[model samples]
Target: MKNYFIVVEGLDGSGKTTAINTITKILNNNGIKDIILTREPGGTPIAEKLRKLIKYNIKGDEITNKTELLMLYAARVQLIEKVIKPALEKGKWVIGDRHDLSSQAYQSGGRNINQKLITYLSNMVIGKFKPTLTLYLDLPPKIGLKRILSRRKIDRIEKEQLSFFVRTRARYLEIASTDSSIITIDANQNLKQVQHEIYKILNQWLKIYK
Candidate 1:
């Protein structure tokens, strides 16, 4: 059995979670049941703790950009090592809600960190391991913000200014443009339309896999 690592990436309220669920269902319907569904920033125990710190200011002080970036990588490496890698070795497919691309968009793009530095960090942590397929759900920050605000309370990262998300989205597009492993989907359409597009992509990919 060939293991697959599938990553779903997008800004908040881009419907990544819903898309992952739908993808999982489709894969299961296809008789791919050895699947591990997870999310970044907190997949493992230690990573979950780091996620809380990163998501909320539990210490009552602002987390500097560098600190936030490092902590995110810390959580990510932990998840990758303790869960994702092992699952893959066991021949289980892993579906990720978010992945390293989020850090590139949010930390390097939104926070104005150097891209080369981020690349170095990524190489150090994840090395040559990359997702088998990445689905990037693209949408405007204005619309995504509206959808999020209406759905739930904003977290620390979500509370950033609209400009932050704009920068992040731009970075996401830039990275996706150069990465052959990434497939960008326009998420501005209706829910059914978006899911249909995702299904189409997955169906094509699975056909090739066979």
Candidate 2:
């Protein structure tokens, strides 16, 4: 079987975890068991450290938009070089919680950074390497924020104004529309419905690989 790299993307509370879990179960049921789960700005030690810095203001210093974007690419390069590529080379299917798309949405859209610079960095750092499939859970920013707030303390990025996420979601949809690899899911539905959609979409996608 050919190894596949899958990425789950969404706002803070768009049910990416549930989608990942459902996808993993679907793959396992299909007799595909050599799978590795990871997340970005994470998945490696250095990346995890960068993840912390990116997600939280541990220090009093304010992270500039360009700096944040560069840090994300740095962490991403580390993850791809140290973890994702190695797993793929070993024939392990990798399911990621988030990936480059997050940088495009969050840093480029939310932070109002120049998209050209982001694209250039993307090309320079990871080149053409990307996920085989990306599941983007789409939902309203208010709804996502409400759901996340009820669950736990919000992170630095999560604490951004509602307008920020609005822009982020806009960018997500814009990019998803253009990218055939990205499949958008309506996450405003109930959990069961969302999972059903995810299962249905993933199951169909798996048929191609099989």
lDDT of 2 by residue, 166-188 (tens): 99999999999999999999999
* Candidates' C-alpha lDDT: 0.93, 0.92
Return the number of clashes found in candidate 2.
Answer: 0
List the candidate 2 regions with Cα displacement exceeding 4 Å: none
Clash totals in order: 0, 0
Clashes of 1: 0
- TM-score per prediction, in order, is 0.97, 0.98
Report the lDDT tens digits of candidate 1 across residue range 77-127. 999999999999998999999999999999988999999989999999999
